[model samples]
Target chain A: MTIKTSNAGVTVIKKLFSRHETFVFLAIVIFGLIITVVNPDFLTLENVFDLLKSYALMGTFAVGMLFVLISGGIDISFTAIATITGYVIAVLLLQNGEQLNIVSVFAIAGGVGVLLGIINALIIYYFNIPSIITTIATLNIYYGLLTVISKGKWLYGFPAWFGQYTQMYVFKFTAANGTSYGLSVITAFWFVLMLIAWFVLRYTVLGRSIYAMGGNSASAKRAGFNLLRLNLFVYGFMGLMAGFGSVIQALLVQTVAPNSLVGKELDVVAAVVLGGASLTGGTGSVLGTFLGVVLIAIMGNGLTLMRVPAFWYKVVIGTVILISVGASAYRRKVSARRRTIIEVE
Target chain B: MERKYSEFLVLFFILLGVIGLMWLLNGSTFMSLNNFRSMAFQLPELGILSMAMMIAMLTSGINLSIIATANLAGIIMALILTQTIPPEATGPGGIGLVILAILAGLLVAAAIGLLNGFLIAHLEISPILATLGTMILVSGLALAITKGYVVSGFPPAMRAIGNSTILGLPVPILIFAAGAVILSVILQRTSLGARIYMLGSNPLACFYSGVNNPRVLMSTYLISGLYSGVAAIVMISRFNSAKADYGESYLLLTVLVSVLGGVSAAGGFGRVSGLILGLIILQIISNGLNLMGVNTFLTVALWGMVLIAVMVLQFLLNRYKEKRRSI
Candidate 1:
């Protein structure tokens, strides 16, 4: 009877949360606890809000990245895509100056995203190139074109509403000690998008197809999945978010520069991979991703609080990607072994 | 093999065409001997890095840490020259000390490659992630050592590698050509080259055939490390300085040069002659565009476009071949 209950418990854990994710979740908790112990201010409401806001842009695109990775490809070019879309929107807004409405801003970003997304999708899927190689080239092309045309132009002094639009608080409060805390629209957008991602991934045919394709593409195709159409949508949808993400960033920075974010795609990729999205694709969760973002944001904030050299952060993030991805690969092997054992039994 | 030579021919003509276009656009100034000399000087650093990348890619693997490894290696050599050797040292002993430094720097670069090999071959991590990790760690170590400042003032013998020309050809070019020939021999004329090609073609098959897959994998990255060492020595000598961030831009461009040279990113297919032609084509396009007063950024864009064009061309060629085979 004890063995039966233990077997059931194992089954339960396996079904609800895979063993690898359980490890990741524990790592996040332990990391958070360590940060809190090192600096109790880390748990403060204001710091929490601040951390969320800081990683909000990365959080937005990490979801888009989740979509791509789940479909068995990777994109480092989204940063370039975001820059192009954001830079265009910033220039247009600056040129129009207070006359531009918000609707058109989103429309333009989304439209541009869809177009570029199709191009990205076509190159990766239709041309049968490795996604990383294709995206690397496009990243160069997109950023290069922007740099040439703009000559490293910086767009500044966005209309007041632009910043306010993203920062419009969904909730706000002031403590007796005068520490104000609030949830901004950006964080709310991130949360809502997380829930939306969970819903789409868990409930939609599109999500199922993507997951199926990523797991075993040949079998998925045999199962009647349309590789061309599905990948086009996946990449296209990412571009749409890139467009939206650029506007969000423009809102935050208030001064948009063309090449400032060129090399930071590594951070986004790190965050998504840390969030438990396998680089080989077909596994990840909204909750895993949210925790990953939270941990990254806190790690950055906590390290700054500790006054560690800023230069070392790149090294730290790179280590995190390696360790996490390495653990996943190890776990994958272990799980395969476990399957063989179970079959033998 | 025939298709390989065809790519070489095509790239050779493209190089000539780019030079002609530049001459037409900018007249005789673009065709001057000085301009050609500078272009040759510029090609070796990029050419060497691309050679390292081609070697890594030949195994259907990549070492994204090439630039970082080169920079790190360069920093080591710089440190030896600037810190160990006395400023006034310029005799036979000084040359001996410089040679020691070069060997030490090469050793460090090879050590890093060994680590990459261990990660990929032993730890079984993907090459991209494995090298990306090392690239970060190595560059961080570099930054820490130099404190983000440039290390300069090497012995003249060391500087001469970058500055001195040998028999009408630049030393750097000579070095680049030597590295290429050695690699070509390794790839085309040796049992080791056959093993590497077989490993890249199918690691599983190689393992089944008892090819000592891990050792082959280790040697490929080891070769990349050796190449980085050579490139680093050249870079340090040419610029007469070293920094953590030097040659950061060359990272992607090397990949472009290799892929554009008809080296398959999926591995098991590449040629040294093809890569050389690709390097020439890029140099001409870049030098020509510079002569035309084009923005440096636009030239970057042009390289990206060229990569895409090559991809499309390959796709069409594959389709046509498939159709012919089917008929």
Candidate 2:
């Protein structure tokens, strides 16, 4: 009876491991173990919290990208959107001397995001331009306009509440070494954003429509899904996330530098694409994206802990993207071949 | 043919409009010989890169790795120049070394292109994803090798390709014109070029029609890479140095130029002449902006605006033509 139960447990484990997210989780564990072995400090709560704090901004962006990729599109403009919106808000706050609360800040940012996202949707839908091309053009336009207007200036000296908000820890404890550490409030934002994304993608009809459009747009249209509405919602959601992410970034860095955010789109793209999100759309999950983010954060942290040169991090990330993307693409080809009808009577 | 010429005419008018605006803004300064000379000197590296991007986009694909490829190729050439050819050398041997270094750089680019092709064609990876992957990997390799430093100090003769004038025209411009001619020939005259357009319009149909689709793709990327190599030589020579991050902003400008030149983002339509006109229009805008002492960032914004404007205009024009045909 014990053997039978053990066999059943083994089967369950195997089934879980077959999932993409679980595989990524396993990779994280094994990689973390290796890093911990190399540096005893790697496993400590202090370091883990540090990693999370650093990646929260990227995590928010990844969730937005996850939506875009799932809808069979790509939006490289998010970084530019985030930067411009954050910079505008910062400049305004600096000029007006108003101590706006965090909620107000987010609302303003998100409002701006929706407006820009609608523009993206309209151009892409009405002009029949590819999402990537449209975003690339918009990215240039938004970033250029921001930089031109701002003269590439950096803004700081936020309202008094900014510090208080960012400084608030979710939980705190002192280490044996007399150093205190806790996850930052910003990480909470990331987590909440992730949960929202997961709920929307997993259970909502809108999410289902997005997936359908991604899987086969023609069929989705035929099935009565409103393509324009879907495009607007998906891209608007992306922009909204970018707005939130921009604020989180500003809070973390304590300044708004217009040029800082535009070039970092690749990191978000890599993280989402690594998580088994098909660029052609119709497949991806928040859980997988979470793992993907964790995996990348770990790799970066582990490499640093191992005393590897920072350049290798990019090499590793690049190789990981290629391998994961290549493996899935190869699998698709095999499945497609298998689906071909054969006459063997 | 009439449709093609009509597109060119639209671009020509836009060019004239920009030139007129710049002339009004800066008066004689914009029309000065020095400005024209500087623009001529400045345009080729970007133009070459744009052409490289154009070839890829012609197949409804993109090589996000074009800038990365140029950097890597330039870095390789820089390494060769710094390592083998001493900075002070001036002789046939030095020239030979320069040639050799250029060859090595081009070879590296070709290899990267082949890798991209293999991944895209045989492995069935999407062009964007595959090229993006290569872009990262190659950039990482470059950063690893250079440790984020610039490679400089080439022999004087090597810099001539960038800075020198040949029979009253800048060498870089000459090279660009020559390249444009060659590319035009290839696109207009070669069977490979015909296959590229066909494949771009519809890949499955091309495949079913007995065309070697993969071979066409491989050749396309190979030519694109070679163009990037040429651009690299010009770039490193012009700057008298090479860095992994050089021309980082050129990637978008190349795309902007391609689109402005009438290259369809969806693929299968573009021409060398149209591309030249696009290049000229952008150069004029940039030069004009500089002459007016306007912020450089605004130029970037204008490029984006121009791209969108052109796209929308084309869309409207196509719709109008359809309506006219129905009538």
Candidate 3:
């Protein structure tokens, strides 16, 4: 009897886990497996590091965006902010003419990001313009401003220290023939940032407030929440992350182009939605977004391995977005109908 | 009394401001007949799209799929005219062929719009999400059909309709005027239009009052789709080529024009006259920028700032009205 009870408990736990996000997580893992099998080199330490480096900056932006989306708002201009701040840093480096330090670049980029975020927060919080429309407008404005400031020039010739900083290894392992593999400092930083973001969203008071506001702003307001202040902080946080993201991006690529991040907002939004954030606001998790990013990256990696046409990727991404959102909507209808039936019963 | 005119007043001021900027930057060139004529011709396609958006807004549903539908229809029309229509009978038979082509486009757009309405109104999907799905599907179909190539070789008469001037005004401008008149009458004088406004303002209340909410919702989307078809015709005529990507740029511009024209984004309130003025304001801004030789990239920034200012002004005006009502 005791053995049977224990086995049943294990089955129950497995069933519960399988019900939510488990399917998606399993899908991602299978995708990774398929890619690795298709190209044995895909599982190499060096290739893994390359993949991590490619996604690090975008992952950071996704972290910040998770906060905004959880609070029932979105920042389409985040990527634009990243590009603009990167350009600013590029300009400063050029003007400094070999005298630039990493600290200076970081400071300029962070400041610009915060400033832009504040502007976005102010308009959205105070004026009551829909976040979607406001962000769309600002996305264009920010990119345009970047173009004007840069005069359509690419920024290159970064200091060797900056490059080394991005590529610095946190840990190294030697295989048989003295070949070494290592995790870069940037990847390590990204992992830590994502973990902290996860903690904040899961455990903090402000984090709870974000969920509360997203779930129902009326109740939150009645409960004495300072919505305007929260709005500012949320947008500002996104901006700061975007700034940091830009710095990492600059370091990784060793160059900045004004149009580098064009049309990237859609990708971030897609990842967020795929992770289960409702566009109607409230009800998502940081872990979900992270998983979302992972899933997208895996899809791209898998498609490339299979040599799928580039255009088909758009079709796939668009289809995924439609299906996920459609499923969510259908689920809501089912639940609502169930509630009505129970009430009638 | 003056408060009732506030929206129009603000729009008029914006128009004057744009005109004054044009004068400051390009003096004589800005006011030249040729430039004005060109602006007139270019305004109609966007104008039609904005009008379509307004109809959707009145029903509290947005059709982001308008551009997609327009693109699909334009491509189909071009393909039929260029590859399918025979050469010898291209004159009178071409007229019949063009009408048939337009009918087919309208049917396709209407079908897509109906699907959108069904999903949004009956199935209880969010309007934005529902329309976005259709936007993707329709645009994909357009791209697939054309393989992303421009279809040209429209007959001369159709080209003439695109290029002809009437009473010193371009044909597109004339079409725009006709559309504005017809739509304004429909919106203000018809019971169906009133029912749409009622449904948009409060659906539950409208239903309780015996309105067929689903029918109203479906018809609004259908009308918007019809307008999209009309816009596609004008677009093909003006450009003399049809491309799947042709309508992509107009999506944002259409929404901007509709919202900035005093059409409430929350729906149930708008005027065709206001939309017409809004289109003109946007066109003048674009044309003025051309004359001033402003960098293309900066145009987005400039427009964003202008939109924000207009939004702020609208917010303040609405607040002022509420304050007065409370007093």
Candidate 4:
């Protein structure tokens, strides 16, 4: 009985190894381990919290981007939208001073995001322009508007409470060595948001609709799914996430620069793809995206800890994206070949 | 007669619209010879990039690496003109340097384009994803070679080629006009052009008809790369400086010109004439924005709005055509 169970466990391990997500999962674990080896401080509880805080906004952007990618589209304009929204929020708070409440600011940011996403959807769905092109154009438009409005100035000097609130510890634990470790409020917020995202993606009709649209738009249309409405919702949701990310970023950094998020869309897309999402649309999971984000964040952190040149980080990222997409293509080809063989037999 | 008149009328109206907008915004300053000269100088490099983009779109592929190719060529040009050949060289040596730089640029770009074509056409990788990889790779190389620094100090003749005008017209504009004419002939009057369109429209049908679809795709990218070399020379000459980051801004602009000019992103449908018109319209909008002192942020938003509008208009037109066919 013990020998049989061990054999069964071996089979399960093999199956996991064969799965696509396993590769990304393993990469994340390995990256984390390497970082710990390079700098023992990297594995410390305080550093972990710092890493989480830094990546919270990036994670938020990835969550929305995952939805868009799953819905068979791309949104390069998200970073631009985030940047402009950050600028607008900064301007409003600076001008209004005592009158602006934190909750109201969040609400306004969400509204701005929905509007931007709606615009993207309208162009893509109504006109049938490729999402990449539409988003690229809008990226320029949004950034241009931000530059004009802000007059290229960096906005700073937020209320002291804003920074404190983002950084405040919500919980603490003592290690066996009598070292105390704490989780910041921002990290707690990120965890809660990600948990909710994971649940919605796994169990909701809208979430499944996103996958359906991406997998095959015509089939989805035949099945009575409203492609236009879904596209709008997906892009709008992406925009809202961008806005939320901006708020988090502003709170964390305590200032907003007009050019703060330039070229960030690439990083977000890379994370989503690395998480096991395909550019061809469909076949991605929020869980995969979460793991992908963790992998990328750890890779960056690990390399920095190892004192690797900054250029190698970009090279590694570019190479990984290339190789992953190549591997996915190869797997599809092999599967197709197998099917052909079975048909012949 | 009516169709001919309509075509002429459309062209006339477009020209008038451009002139009227410029006149309204900057008054006589917009029509000034100096402004015209500057505009003329600007058009060639972008024009070449636009043509490259159009050809790629025709093949149902995209060449995101075009700007990278141009930047690479621009770096080579700077190095050759500034450091390699002496300022006093004449005749064969001077010509040799120009030829060598141009050839190196074209060759490097073509090799990259070929890699993209093979991956996309043969391996079945998505064009966007494949080109994106090359884009990153090439840009990284460009940065590594130049180390984010500018290279300048070209010989007098090279500078003249870039900066000089002929008969009250800039030389770059003249180069653009010449390129447009050649491209028109090749696209409109040649069998190769027909094969390209057929392949783009329906690859399976073309393959059944004994056309080598892959070859058509490969050649299109090669031409795009060659054009990138030409555009790079023009750009380096005009700016009087070559840097790794020079053509980063051109990526979106190139796509915008292709789409707005009536080249269907779906492939197999487009005209050189329409692309030329598209280029003019885009440049005018850009020039107008600059002249009017529009806020930079608002300018981008406005451009985005325009792109969205153009795309919607194209979609409506396509739908209308389909409806007519069904009827």
Candidate 5:
């Protein structure tokens, strides 16, 4: 009887391990434990909260990237989009001596993002340009235009209410060491956004059409899916996420530097790809993306706790991305070779 | 052949038009010999890098790691030169050490290219992802070694490689010219060249025809790596320093130049002559902008706009040609 129950438990564990998200989750747990073993502070509630707070921006961007990748395109320009909107809005607020209104800020930022994203979609579809090529050009155009207009200026000294809004937390607790810990409002926003993305991707026709388009664009078109509309929605959604993420970044860092956000597009791309999104498109998940972000956060935090060189973080992230993507590609090739096709013809 | 000639003709005229515009805008300043000389010097590093990118794109692949590979190789060479030889030394011994350093750097680049090729071809990883991974990893390695410091103080002879004039032309430009000739010969005259075009145009067809796709791809990246190594040599010599972050902006510029040269992004098409025309056009525009004292950021924006504009033009031309053919 014990053996039978143990066998059932083994099957359950095996089934869970079969999932990519579960594998990433397990890696995160193991990595976290190893870090805790090295530095007990790594597992502390304060540090945990700090990790979530720091990685919230990346997580938000990863969600946005997931939408684009699932729709069978890539957009490296989102970083430029984010910086342009965020910087322009902050500069405008500073010039006009206006207070930060949360609703207005988001509306303006997100609206700008949607506008840019629609332009990207229009240029791409109308010209039949490759998504990567279009985005690369736009990445330069947006970033260059921003720098030219702003003279590469940085913005600080946000309104008092913006600072106060950032300090608000969903919950707070005192740790055993008498240190207070709380997840910030921005982190909570990340969670809410992730949940919304998960719901939209899992249950919406828009999401299904995106997957269908990515899986096979020709088939999706034949099935009556509007490729142009899908392109607009996905790119536009990506812009919205970038806008939200930019706000979150500003909230965390309390500064808007135009140049800081452009080059880090790779990190966001790495996170989403690590989450099992194929560059070729048509495959990704919210859970998997969340776990991917967690894995990176854990590795980054753990390395810092262990006093590893900051540069090593890039090496680790790069290796992790290559290994994960290579493994998946190998698995796909093997599956393709092993599949049995019925000889109906 | 006639169509290809017309394409070149159009690019040549565009180059002349750009030069004419620059002359119209800046006149004597743009027409100055000193300005022309400086532009010639500046063009080679970027020009060589564009060729490297074009070669990879020819195989329907890209080496996003090209800049990173160049930096790492240059870093390695810098380390060797700095460690082995004293600063500003110009003896025969120094020349020998420089040669050793150059070869060693090229070897390092080749190894990186081999690794990228392995990941993309053998492991079947997509070129973008594979090269991106290598790019990050290599750049991190470079940063870890240098700790974000610039490596400088090469022997005078090495510096001369960048600054010296020979036969009334800059040595670097001469190098670029020679490299272009060699590359053109390799692409147009060799079996490897044919295989590259075939592979880029259709990999499965190439494979089924008994060509070794993996080997062809490996060679393609290896050649790309060597070109980047050469570009690094030019860059470091020109600046008299090597840094992990050097030429970050050149990545997009190289892409722009290649596409402007009429290299198909989907691959299987491009020419050295067209690329040279593209380089000349860009060089003139850049030189003109500097002479006019336009904002550098605006120049970058202009490059982006030019890239899009050229792409749009290509699309229209292709559509028009197809319509004519159908009629």
Candidate 6:
């Protein structure tokens, strides 16, 4: 009986390891291990925790991007959305000082994001304009507006309480090498958001419909799905995330450059794509996105450790995008061809 | 056919509107000879870039790498010119080398275009993701080339194209006019242009019709590359320098200009004339705002607002038309 149970356990392990998320998780582990081997300081508790902490806001963006991608569209404008909403919050925080309630900032940022997201949804759904194209235009508009209102000004030296709130670390430790480490409120927020995204995508009717829309829109329509309403919710939710992402980014960085997040749409979108989210949409996961965010943060941290020039990072990102996207596409083609061959046989 | 006429009429009125607004805001100063010359100079580089964007968008594709490609091509040409021309060589020999550099830059740019075409048309990747990758890669390569430094000092002859005026017209504007004419002919008269439109409209149908779709797509981007090569020359001349990041801001602006010109983002439709009008309106708005002491960043926002407004209006019009047809 013991031998039979062990055999069943091995099969269960094999089944679990075959998932895309499993590979991504392993890749993160392998990456960590490899970096730790090369520069042993990399495995230090402080450094590892710091690496995870860095991706807190980006993880937020990826979660949002994953939703948009799963619905068979792209949203490059989210970066712009994040910038504009964050700028509003920052300006309010600076001007209002003692009188401004923190809750109001969150509400305003979220409200602005919802408004912008609805605008995106309305234009995209009403006209069926390509999401990327529409977002491209909106990205410019939003960033342009931010720069105008901010007048190229950067907000710095946030109220210490604001920063300390998110910066509050839940875990703390010190190593023999005298390095200190802790998981912060921001990191907790990232995980909680990821968990919520996973739950929404997994357990909700809206989440499954997002997948159905992406998998096959025409069939989804035939099955009585409302693409327009779904788009509004999906893009609006993305905008809300952007608003939250902005708050997280602003609080963490404590200096809001109106144009800081302008070009980061590519980075956010790339992470989602790297997580196995299809550009063609209808497929992705919350866990996969979290892993993707981790992979990027780790890679960037590792590269910095290796002393690679920061400028070459785009090359690395570009190559990864091409290879990952091409490989997935090629796999799909091969599988389809194989299925056709089987049918003929 | 009526749509074409309506677009032209709308462009004419918008042009008039900008002129009227400029006149009202800045009065006679906006119409000064110097203002016209500066505006003319500013117009060509963007105008040419918009034309380049138009061709790509004609196929419902976006080449986010135009500024990068232009900068790289200009850098290479600058390198060649700087290498071949001795500081003392101010004669016809310097002129000859400049021409050679232009040809080389155009050649390299065309090759880049073909690579973009192959990635999109043959590889079957979404245009956005494919071009996004190439944009980053190519720009990285450009950055690696100069280690992020500017290259400058072209021969007098090369600079003349931008700085000199011919027949009371800026040379850049003349070149732009010539380019516009040539492109209009190529797109309207040539078999290649027709095939591109057909392919853009429906690739599967084109395949059924044996239209050599990939080759058409290749040539489409190749021409866009060649146009970028031309725009690079004008830009380098205007600035008297070339750098990896020059014109970096124009990437999104070109899209704005293209779509605002009524180029269907869905592919299979766009016009050079309409684009020219759109670009002119943007130039006027920019120059006019500069004169009025409005923040330059606000202009960027204005462009965005204009684009969004235009997109929304287009949607409304399409809806109205659909509704009418259903009746």
- Number of the predicted model whose DockQ against the real structure is largest: 2
- Indicate the worst ten consecutive residues by lDDT in candidate 2 chain A: A336-345
Whose lDDT is greatest here? 2
lDDT of 4 by residue, A30-95 (tens): 877877887887787777777888898889999999888888788989998888788778888788
Reference-based TM-score of each model: 0.94, 0.95, 0.88, 0.90, 0.95, 0.91
For each candidate in the order shown, give its overall lDDT on alpha carbons.
0.84, 0.88, 0.79, 0.80, 0.87, 0.82
Q: Where does candidate 1 stray beyond 4 Å? A: A1-18, A97-104, A340-345, B85-93
Model 6's CAPRI class is medium
Lowest summed lDDT window (length 10), candidate 1 chain B? B85-94
Candidate 6: which stretches are off by over 4 Å? Answer: A1-38, A91-108, A342-345, B83-93, B322-327
As for model 4, its CA RMSD to the true structure in angstroms is: 3.4
Task: Flag regions of model 2 displaced more than 4 Å.
Answer: A1-18, A95-99, A341-345, B85-93
Question: Measured with DockQ on alpha carbons, how good is candidate 2?
Answer: 0.69
Superposed Cα RMSD, model 3 = 3.6
Model 1 whole-model lDDT (C-alpha atoms): 0.84
Choose the strongest candidate by TM-score.
5
Residue B241 CA displacement from its true place in model 6, Å:
0.9
Q: Runs in model 3 with CA error above 4 Å?
A: A1-20, A26-49, A97-104, A171-182, A343-345, B1-6, B9-25, B59-63, B85-93, B133-147, B166-169, B189-192, B203-218, B247-249
lDDT of 1 at B268: 90
Candidate 5 per-residue lDDT, tens place, A273-345, comes to 7888876648889988988888888988899999998978888888888888887778667655666443332
lDDT of 2 by residue, A1-345 (tens): 898879988999987855667767777899999999999999999999988988998999899889989998889999999997898689777877466777888999988987898899999999988888888889999998888788788899987777676678899998887988897888988999999889988899998999999998899999999999999998998899899988988888889998788888988888888888887649889988988999999999899999999987888888888887887777677766766744332
Taking all chains together, the TM-score of candidate 3 against the true structure is 0.88
